[model samples]
Target chain A: MSQDLVFGLYIFALATFVGYQVISRVPPLLHTPLMSGTNAISGISLVASLVVAGEHHDRFAAVLGFIAVTAASINVVGGFMITDRMLRMFNKKKAPALAKAGS
Target chain B: MRESLINLAYLVASVLFILCLRGLSSPEQGRRGILLGELGMLIAVVATLFKAEIVSFEWIIAGAILGSLIGTAISLKIPMTQMPERIALSHAFGGLATSLVGIAEFHRMRDMADAAATVVAVAASEHALNRLTMGSLGFEVFLGSLTFTGSLMAFGKLQGFITGAPVTWKGQNVMNFAAFAGVIGLLVYQVIFLTAAPQWMFFTMCAVGFSLGVLAVLPIGGADMPVVISLLNSYAGLAACATGFALRSNILIISGALDGSSGLLLSILMSKAMNRSFANVLFGAFGTGGGAAAALPVGQAAKGYNEATVEDAAAVLTASQSVIVVPGYGMAVSQAQHAVRDLATALEKRGTEVKYAIHPVAGRMPGHMNVLLAEANISYDALFDLEMINDDFARTDAVIVVGANDVVNPGAKTDAASPIFGMPVFNVEQARSVIVLKRSMNTGFSGVDNELFYMPNTMMVLGDAKKTLISLFGAVKGDGH
Candidate 1:
């Protein structure tokens, strides 16, 4: 019922709206790059959640914070693993005969 | 409620997550990034479990156990070849869960208000109206719904349940434009209607969201999977962000925003790699194989380059000091990257210097060959890009063309009448000798006979890529005779 709470909620709503609009217009071709790039941002969220939870001495707040941290962490970990795997595919060695046979 | 502990935990977790993401940007440190992310999650989960009011511990436990089991099963069963599809499917699940959570929360609030009014016997419905006033819930519902459906469609396409080509009519762009307009119109209408009476508008919006997801992915082809995958990733992130807003969670918003932006950047890089615009990739009819001009007959080419057996190829390779391997879409189709890797290892043991020459557009997708090679666990330093290895061909004792055609075809650069005239190709002919391994003298995806096949220095090794590579590997290792 507080004015500050209402203002905070409104700001979040605005962010959601703006974020949705921008994301929807994104060309499908830019998906991977965008995903990889935003992956870092997701990291920021994890940090924010952690900080919030640590500050809240209340048991409920702490628990919620932990959950957020866990989920975000999963996203970050899996994302990097997959990205690294993808990049390595680009530099695979060829059979040696290819060099010898061509000569 | 003490806030200091919560803030501190949030800060540490966020810092770790950021560091993890930054590490993932490069191929070398990507694994570290994953570990950091895992650490962040562990911290978040432990922190959240400390909450006091969460009475449904049983449900959370059950959900966590089930989820972990499923995740483990998927990771163990799915091959690296199907990793992209798995990621897409995961995105869909994430979006769906977020949407369901928003719906549940919204309904709970509505029911609570209704119950309070009934118990008090109040004539005013103002409390119930106020409960439904949160715009964050609606936004979450919309974005989550869209991401869920869109990601599913993408998964289906990648899995080959749907055609990979751009599904469009003559005026498809106009239709897409109109559909988008209609979605916006309905969204506005729903918002206005929600202010008064909750009608079928909510369901209608969900339907529109689902349709938008389908429409967004329907135009992309199999060849442009990297871009599509990245875009879907962004949708999932944005959906998460929406969920955060609905829940008034700052962590969610920040993480979601990060995911959304990275997905955008990845798509851009992938598009640039293909030398195409994002718009062109989206609207263009891709994966139309066999549309190129018919290839010239094998017999019509210069007589010296007629097909030879694997034994002959082995002889030349064994006698040669240096070999250059050129791979193409055929190698990918036959899944012969491992065989090629094996053959390379064998040759290297024989004191033969082997180097792989990769063309920019060798396989169906960008980095297709690289992915295959990586799966074979070949060393990174051994693979050479076209520019890096082209000049060295002249000194090569033999050039082994494995399932490669268009990329190494001399006609692409020298022959004016060639359909792929301007496309850059490997200068394989510059090598002192050339050996091509193929099932037949068929042309490539571009549908043109490779003139390099008939060049004086070239000899065709006719057979399946996998079988031929295996035989060649055996032959090279058999006494080096």
Candidate 2:
């Protein structure tokens, strides 16, 4: 394998292990948030799309890149915000009666 | 210097993503995790802008702004009940983006190779697209395309636009397998021949892949959606990993691997919760399969189960010292979570200890029941899992099962003929009195008759769960004696 391919493989393999271990430790109650959180992680591709769309490429390539940038940007921005909104619902209730009940 | 700075920034972003995932392991740190992830994304996007390859920013800025607005609107507009559908739609978008990027990269490099070969010498730069790039890009496009269509199907089912039941015709599996094999054959050819492969070949392969995705998911029943959605999520992650290989981006490699594997883990967990194998969940005929293990005897009238008046249920609840409320998809269908919550609060007023029994696969998605209840403003502390509260059921005064069927069915534990035989169920039968609120004697998602309703300790209260709960609340209030 080429050096670049080998390097990428090494990163991919280790990160897969980390992902499994991290996700497995999460409680069942948080699965939805875990899903949306990782959804945002996949949005990292938005960075590459931005570069591809901005560069002086052929028109066809540029159009493709523009769509990718828009789609990925939506995934990142929407994914994080939605996840944040959901996670807030997971917070402990702060109702005054429940608060003094000594949870 | 600029290159080094970009690499360093990517490295930092990758580290933040790892930390962000770790934070998501607990609910307390979940908000911080999202913020940290946001910061990581911002850093990566800003660093890419400084790479010196970019000549113009107009398209990038315009697309980013427009996309963010739409995304924000979607996230805000979708209700908690519709979260699964919305997530499936987002996965489709992610897969589409990855597939498009792969196609663009392939074409750009192929054109460059063609130009150089014509100007310089025979086969000079024609082979510039190396074997590894060719293979990875081919793999990326295939997975991305499949995920795109598969997730759209999932979205359709969850949104009620399509029938949630598995649509199996004769030779369904055979057709899906053949189409997918064709996509593989084309990918292998492209991988071996590299740039010598025809451009149309790759595009044709992508089209086949999209078809295979739709076929693969169509036969999966709604009961098995958690697994299918999780699998689609994993596919999107794998496509992203391939994209990382194509782009030589470290962040993509790291984050994609994480996203892909985490999705796989969830699928496995979901399958186990349902007490079924991945093959059983994916390929088994499921609800319509001939292996149906319903415990109900044919031609037997409802002889064993007793119909109870709302007053009898009210009497039991008002006098009970300890109660456990089990809410299921029926609760979701009636939008009765708020009513369930109100009932709990009223019971609590009488010093009745009320808690919830949440099965892992209770609603549509994993942790779905929790989200619905959480939206009802129920305190998280009052909820308990099967293991945590199962033992306490026998000593409990009353267990109110609202709109739940199979999860509480004792047949899973005792009936060897049951399709859900090995599935762990809520031990509601062990409680002193079991009050099941049902619209009728209909089976649950598993399409199996619940034996719990007939048990001597159980009483079936018929009607829509929301209306029943409201009536029972009145009865409880007036039961002054």
State fnat for each of the candidate structures. 0.11, 0.72
Q: Second chain only: TM-score per model?
A: 0.78, 0.94
Instruction: Report the lDDT tens digits of candidate 2 across residue range B5-122.
Output: 9989988998888888888877789889888888888898899999898899888988899889989999999888787887898889889888888888888778878887779844
| Candidate 1 residue-wise lDDT, B1-481, digit = tens | 5445654675566556566555544446545655665676567656665655344354454445544555555545665546556667666655665555555555544555566666774434344433324455566666667777877877887677987665665677777678667756665664454334463555566676777778767876665666676666666677666666555565566567656765665566566545467787676644434243542553454445667888888889888888888887678667788898888888887778877887655554334555566678776566777668889998899998888776787887778877556666678898888998888865554456677877777888888889999988898788545
True contacts kept of 2: 0.72
* lDDT of each residue in A1-103, candidate 2, tens digit only: 6898899899999999988888888888788878888888898878777777887678888898889888898899899999899888775764443343344
What is the TM-score of candidate 1? 0.72
Per-model CA lDDT versus the true structure: 0.62, 0.84
Computed on C-alphas against the true complex, the DockQ of each candidate is: 0.12, 0.65
Candidate with top lDDT is: 2
lDDT of 1 by residue, A1-103 (tens): 6453465456445544544444444333223322433443443343334443354434544554445444444444444445544544534345554566555
Q: Give the range of the ten consecutive residues with the poorest summed lDDT in model 1 chain A.
A: A25-34
